[model samples]
Target: MEINHLTAAEARVWRAFARGETVDFRESPDEDPADGGDWGAERTLRAGVLRALLLDGPRQDGEVPSLSVAGARITGRLDLQHATTDHPVRLRNCHFDEAPRCYAARLRELNLSESLLPGLVAHAVHVDGILRMTRTRFTGTVRLGGARIAGSLYLESAQVSAPGTEVPVLQLNQASVGADLSAPGLRTQGQIRLNGATVAGSLNLSDARLGNPEDAALDAQTLTVGGDMLLRHAEVHGWLGLRGARITGRLDLSYVLLSNPGGSALQASSTAVGELWLRKAPPMEGTLNLRRAQLDVLFLEPDSLPQEVLIGDLTYTSLVPHEPAERRLPMLERQRDGYVPHAYEQLTAAYRRVGDDHAARLVQLAKQRRHRNTLPWYGRLWGLVQDVTVGYGFRPMRAAGWLLSLLAIGSVAFALHHPQPLKAGEAPPFHPVFYTLDLLLPVISFGQEDAFAPSGGYQALAYVLVLTGWILATTVIAGVTRTVSRQ
Candidate 1:
C-alpha cells in the first residue's frame, strides 16, 4: 500500500472531507522521510461543493498522523467507515448544513468540540477511545441511535437548539454507554429519548434544560444506571418520565424543576431507588406520581418555603418489624398501633400546606378510622346518654327524679292529713307502728311498751326524720356510683 496523490476524482473526495461531509477513507503507507518524501503524501482538496462523500481503503500502519478537516461548509451526508488514525481527528469550526453520517469510523478520538452542525447521524460510530464534544452547537436534530463504544461519552456544555424551519432537535435511541453520561449543561429543544439504554456508571444531567413543553423532556424508560442518577438542577419544561427505570444507587432530584401542566411532572412509577431525596422540587400543577415505587428510605426534610410533598399511595412495610431490645432506643417511634395514624397525619400536613382542604379532610377521616376502637371516656359517656334518649324514647334519669320527689310529697301529705291522737288510751284509728316499725326501729322496740311508746306527735316527727335520712342516704349512694362509673 504505497502513498498515492489525489487524482481529479479523488480530489473531489478530499474536497468533501474538507467541507465536513461524512467520508469513509482507507489508510495508505507513509513515504520514508529519507527519500525525497513523496511530495503528494498528504491528502488535500480545495473547499467548495460541500456534499456527502465516502472515503475507504487500507493504509500502512502508522502512516497518517492526524485527520484534520478544519474550516469548510459541508452539506448532505458524510461517512468515514473503518478509518484508522494514530492521533486525534479535529473538525473544529466547519459547518455541516445537512445530516453527516459517520458509521463504524475508527479514530484515536473524534473532537467535534466547537463545530456548527445542523444534524449528526452517527450510528455504530466506534471511536478507539472517548468522544469529547465540549460546547458544540447542533442547530437541528441529532441522532446517535444504536451506537456502541468502550469509553465515556462526554457532552459537557453542549447546546441542541431547535431548527428554525420546524424540525426536531435531538434523539438518542438505544445508545449504550460503558461509563458515565456527563451531559451537564445540556440544552435540548425537542424530546430526548434514552429508552432501553444502559449506563454502567452514573447518568449526570445536572443543569440540563429541556425546552419542549408539549413533548416529554426526558423519556428514560427501562434505563438502568449502575450508579446514582443525578438530576440536580435539571429544568424540564415537559414531563420527566422515568417509568420502569432502575437506579442502583440513590436517585437525587433535589432541586429539579418540572413544569409540565397536562401530564404528571415526574412519573417514576414502578421504578426503584436505593434512597430518594426529593427535598425541594419546583411547584408542579399535576401530581408527582410515584405509585408502586420502592425506596429504602424516603427523606422529607423541611424546606424554607411551604412546599407540598405528595406521597402517593405508597406501600411501605418495615423490613425489620422488631429490633433487638439492646439496640432499641426510646425516641419518637411509630408503634404498630400508631403507624397508620402517623402516616395519615403526615399526609394531612402535606395537603394542608398546599391549601387542599379536601385532601386534608380525607386524611383526617382515615386517621379516625385507625383509632375507631379506642374512644375517650367522656366521649363514650355522652354517646351513651344520646343513645338512651333516642332508643327507648325515655329520659330515665329525669323520670326517676320526678317519681322520687312525688313519693316524698305523698308521705308528707299523709302525715298532715291524719294527725296522731293526743291520748294513747283512746285507740288511734290506725296503729302507726306498722308503717313506722321499719322506719323507727333504731328509736323504739316492740317488747318494752312503756319505754318504746312515745307521744303520737313525737312519733310523727320521728317518722319524718327517718324518711328524710333514708332519702338522703339513697341519693348520696346513687351520686357516688355514677361518678365512679364515669371515671
Candidate 2:
C-alpha cells in the first residue's frame, strides 16, 4: 500500500467515516432500493479518499469506522483503476449514481451483495478473495471482461436487466475464475455472455431464467471449465451456445426447459465434454445441434428426446439406454424428416469404438431397416431384394448360397431326365449331369446341353436354371460394385 495524504474534501469524508457518520446518498429516505436509485442525492467521494482509508485506516488504532454506510447514495463514478488494496470494502444496500469502475484493480475482497446500482464495470480486475453481488438489481449491463478472480463469483438471485434488445445483461468475456460462477435463480432480460472464459470450478445456473425467446440465452463460446457446467432445472427461452468449449467434467442439462423457435436451442458444435447429459429433461423445443462434438458419455432419458436434433461428426464413447438396441434405435430418431445416414453411422461408430460389436451391428441393421422404410414402394421392394439376397451388398455368402442351390437342382433334373445323344457331335454319348452344368454356367459351355434334347419337365426346368443363374450373377456384380464404392 502506498502512503498518501488525503485532500480536504477527501479527509472530510474519511473523518466522517472514522467518526461513524451515516453517509446518505439517497435523496429521499422513503424510496426503496428497487426504485433503481434514480432519486438519490449522491455524495461523490474522490478516489484518493478510498485509497487513503484503505492504506492508513487500520493503523489509526480503531479510529476508523466499521465502513457501514447503509442506504447511502454514492455519486459520480467510484474509480478504483489499477489500485491494489488489501482491505475489504462492503457497501451494502447502497445506491450508486454511476457504475463503479474497477478496471485493472486488484482487491483483497469485495461484497456489494443485495445493493441497487446502474451497472458494474470490472474489466481486468483481479480479486484475491470472493466477489459477491448476490440478489442485486442492475438497470444496465454488468460487464466483467478480462477479470481474473481467485475465488467464487456469487450472483445467486441477481436481477440484471439491459434496456436494449440483443444486449447482454451480464458479460464475463475472457474472464478467468478460480471457482464457480454461481448464479442460481437469477432473472435476466438479456443474454449472459461468457465467451473465452475459464472456470476452475462448476457453473451453477440451476433454476435461473435466461434471455428472450429466439435470441441466444447464454453465449459461452470457447469457454473452458475444469468442473461441471450445471443448468439443471433451469428455464432457457433462447439458444444456449457452447461452441468450441471444453469441459473436463460433466455438462449437465437435466430437467432443463429450453425453448428456441426456428433455430437450435442448444448449439454445442466442436465442444469436448466428459459427459453430454440430457437425462430427465423436457424435450427441447428447437434443434439440439451437436455437430463435431466429442462426448465421452451420453445419458438420455425416455421420451425426453428433443423434437428435432441434427448430429454431424459427433463422437460419443457410450450411450446409456435402458432398453435393448432393437427398441432404443427406433425411438432415437430426432430428425424432423428424411433419413439421416450420419445419425446411424455415428451411433454405430460409437458402439464400435467401445468394442461393442454386437451393439454396432444391431444399430447398423436398424439403420438399413429404417432407411428402407423411408423410400418409395418400388425403392422399398428393391431394398428388400438387396437385403434378402446380399444383405445390402454386405453379405456375399448369401449370393453364393443361392448359386450353389440352383446348380445342385440343375444337376439332379438333368440326371433324372436322361437326355438323348446329339445327332452330330464328336462327343459320343451326352452325359445328362454334365449337360446340365453347361446350361447353368452361361459363361462356360461343356458342349453337352448344347447338343442334347430333353423332353417332359426336364426342358422346362433347364430354361428356369439358365434364367436364375443370370439373375444371381448380375446381382452379385451389382453388390460388389456398391460395396467397393461405399468403402
Candidate 3:
C-alpha cells in the first residue's frame, strides 16, 4: 500500500491501525449517522486499503495491530477469503457498498456493531475471539455456516431482511461455537436456520421476532446445546422446527406467540431437553408437536395449549403447576392424530409417580374410552357396557350400585307375587325376601327356592332375576380381577 495512492480517510486508518486507536469519521465525537449516509471523500475509504492495512500493516514492539474504524463508508469488496490475520477488526457504525466476504478466513475478534452492510459471508471462517454484530443491519443474507468460534457470537438487536428468498437470511448451519449465541431483540424477515449447529454455551434469542409466514421461521433441526436455549417472549410467524435437537439445559419459551396456521407452530419431535418451559404462552394457531420428545420437567398450562397437539410418544418425568386429571386429561384428548395410548399411559404414570392415585385412575379410565373408539363395533359395544357399569374396571363403586339396584328389584317383585308350592305340605314357607335372595345368589340354595315353583308372570320374573344375577356377578368378578391385576 503506497502512501501516495491512499486517500485521506484511508491514510488516517493506516496510521491508526498499529496504534490501536479508532478513526471516527463523524463530524463530532458524539455524532451518529442515522442511516449511514451523507458521506464525502473525508469519510470514504477503499475496502482494499483497509484489507491491505489489516494484512500487512506496520507494527511496533508493544502496539497491537488492529483495524478500528467507525462512521466510514467502505467502497469495493473486502475479500479476505482463505486469509489469516492476528489483528482484531472493529468496524463500528460503518456503511459498505459491497458485502464483506471473509470465507474461510482466520482472525481474532471481529466486531461490526451498529454497522449498515449489504450482507456478510463468513462461512467456514475461524474466529479466535468473540464475533460481535450487535445493532447491525444487513440487507442480504448473513451466512456464517461451518464457522468455528472460540468465543460467543452476539447479534443483539440486529435486523436482517432478505425477502422472497427460499434460503434463510441468517444461516449458522453446522457452526460450532464454544460460547453462547446471544441474539436477543433480533428481527428477521426471512428464516433463521441453525441446523446441525453445536453450541457449548446457551443460545438466547429472547424477544426475537422471526417472520417467514409461508415457511419455517427458525429451523434448528439436530441442534445440540450444552446450556439452556431461551426463546422467552419471542414471536415466530412460521413453524419453529427443532426436530432431533438435544439441549442439556432448559428450553424456555414462556409468553411466546407462535402463528403458523394450517401447519405446526412448533415441531420438537425427538427433542430431548432437561426442562421445557411453555408457561403462559397463548394458544398457537397451529399444532404443537412433541412427538417422541423427552423432558425431565415440563412447565406448561392446559389453557396455554394449542388446539392441535401431537404428543404421540412425548415422555416427561415431571409436570409443573401439578394440575389434576380434569385439567390435564384434555391435553391428551386434543391429540388429533387419532388415539395414542402411550399419551394416556404417560399421564397416568406421571400422576401415579406423584401419589395421586385417583387422578391416575381417571386417566386410565380415559385411556380405555379413547381406545374403545378405535375398536370394532362389537368390541366397542362390550367396552360401552364395561364403561357404563364399572368405568372399564376403574370405577368399582358403579358395580356395587348395579348390584344393590338389582337386589332391590328382585326383592320387590317376589314380595308382590307369591309362588305356588311344588308339594302340598312338604314345601317350606315362601318367604319373599329369602326366596328372592336365594334366586339372586347363584350356586346357593335357601331351600325355599327349591320347594316353591313360580307360575305365569312370577316364573318369568324369576328367570330374569336369575340371569341378571349371573351377569352382575360375572362383571363384578372380571372388573375386580382387572383392577387387582393392575395394582
Candidate 4:
C-alpha cells in the first residue's frame, strides 16, 4: 500500500506515527466530535491507512513508532486480525464508522478512551500493556474472550449497549488479565460476561448499572479474582450470577440494588470468598442464593436481607454487626427452602464463636422451633411439650420450678384430707407431707404410705400424684440427657 496521495488528516497521522506525536483534531481536549465542528475528509482517516502506518511505517532516527490520534473519524474497518504491531495505539475521542477487528492480534498497548465505536471484536488478542476504554461508548458487543492482557484492563465510566439484542454487550469470558480489571461506573444495557476469566488483581465494578431484563446482567461464574471483587452501590436489573467463583479477597456488595422478580437476583452458590460485605443494601426483589458457598466473614444487615435465601451449607466463619439471635433469626427464617437446619446451626455457631452463649442458646431454640414446623402434628405436640416444660432441654430451671410446684400441690392435697391407719395402734404417725412425698416418690416408701390406706377420692388423688411424678421424672431425664449429649 502506497502511503502517498493521502488526505490532510491521514498525512498528519502518518507523519505523527513516525515521530511518536499525538495528532489531536479537537481544539480542546474535552471537545467531542459532535460539538459543532466540520468532520469531513479534513478530519477523516481511512482505517487501512492507519493500519498500513502501524504495520509498515517509516521509522525515524531516534523517535519510537506510535499511533496516537484524538477527536478524529475513522471510516473503514481497522482489521488487524492475526497481525502483530509493536506500536501503542491510542484513538481517544474518535468516531468509528465500523467496528475494529483485532482478532488474535498482538499489540503493545491500546487505549480507546472517549471514543464512539459501533462495536469491537478483539477476541484472542494479546496486549502487552494496559487495554483501556475509559469514558468510551460502544453501541454493539465488545468481545474480548480468550484475550490476554499483561497489564490492567480499564473500562472506567464506559457505556456499552447492544439495544434489542439478547447477547452480552461486553464479553470477557476466559480472558486473562495479569493485573486488575477495573471498570468502575460502567453502564451496560445487555449482559456483561466474565465467566472463567482470571484477574490477578482486584475486579472493581462499583457504581455500575447493568441491565438485562431477560437474563443475567453479570454472568461471572467460575471467575477467579486474586484481589477484592468490588460491586458496591451497583444496580443490577437482572440476575448477578457468581456461581463457583473464587475470590482470594472480599466480595463487596454493599448498598447494591438487585431486582429480578420470580428469579434469582444473586446466584452465588458454591462461591468461595475471604469476606462478603452485603451491608446497608435494600431488600432485593428476588432470591439471594448462597447455597454451599463459604466465606471467612459475612457482613450482612437485617434490612439488607432479601425475601428468600438459600443458605443450605453456606459456611461463614463470622457474621458482622454481632447482633443477637433475635435479630439474626429472621434472616434464617427467610430460607428459600421450607426449613434448613444447617443455616440455623451455622448461625448458632457464629454466635458461639463470639462468646455470646445466651445468643447461641436462643438460636438453638429457634432452630428447634423451625424444625418442629416441618414435623407431623403428633411430633409437633411432643416438641411443644418439651419446649414449654424445659425449653427443649435448654432451660433446666423450668424443670426445677415444675418440680417445686408439684411438690407443693401434692403436700397441700394430702394435708387437707388425712388417710385412715391400716393397723390401728401399731401404725406410724400420720404426716401429710411424708404421705404425699411417699405417693409421689414412686420408688421410695416413706413408711407413712404403707401404714395408711386412702379411700375413694384420696386414693384416686394418690394415683394421680404417682402418674404426674413419673411424667415429670421422664421429661427431666430426657432434657438432661439431651443437654449433656449436645455438650
TM-score of each model, paired residue for residue: 0.55, 0.74, 0.96, 0.96
Candidate 3 residue 326 C-alpha distance from true site, Å: 1.5
lDDT of 1 at 45: 29
Query: After superposing candidate 4, which stretches have Cα over 4 Å from the reference?
Result: 34-38, 441-451
- Model 2 lDDT per residue over 401-429, tens place: 87777777877777666777657555557
Rank ordering of all candidates by TM-score, starting from the highest: 3, 4, 2, 1
**Candidate 3 Cα outliers beyond 4 Å, as residue runs:** 28-34, 443-445
TM-score of 4: 0.96
Model 1, 1-487: lDDT tens digits are: 1114434534544444434343432233232211211223233222222111223333344354344554434444455555444445565545555556676565567777656676676766666667767767887777766666557777778888765634446655577888887888888887887887788888888898887786678888888889888878888888888888888887877787777776667778788777666657655544466666767655533331122223444433221222222221111122322333445654555555556555555454344433543667775554344333321112235434543554455346444544344455564354334334434334444432222334566556556746654544444444445335523
Report the lDDT tens digits of candidate 3 across residue range 69-122.
Answer: 998988899999998999999999888888999999998999999888888999
Candidate 2: C-alpha RMSD to true structure equals 6.3
Each model's lDDT: 0.56, 0.77, 0.89, 0.90
lDDT of 1 at 238: 81
Model 1 residue runs over 4 Å out of place are 1-64, 69-72, 81-88, 103-108, 164-168, 302-366, 369-487
lDDT, candidate 4, 1-487, per-residue tens = 6556798788888888989999988867778744422577788989999889889988999999899999898988999999999999999999898999999999999999999998999999999999999999998999999999999999999999988777789999999999999999999999999999999999999999999975899999999999999999999999999999999999999989999999999999999999999888889889999999999999998888888988999999999888867889988888868688889889988988889989988888888888899899998988888888788778879877876777788788778887889989999888888888787676788898889899999799888878877766666778788768877
Candidate 1 TM-score versus the reference: 0.55
Clashes of 3: 0
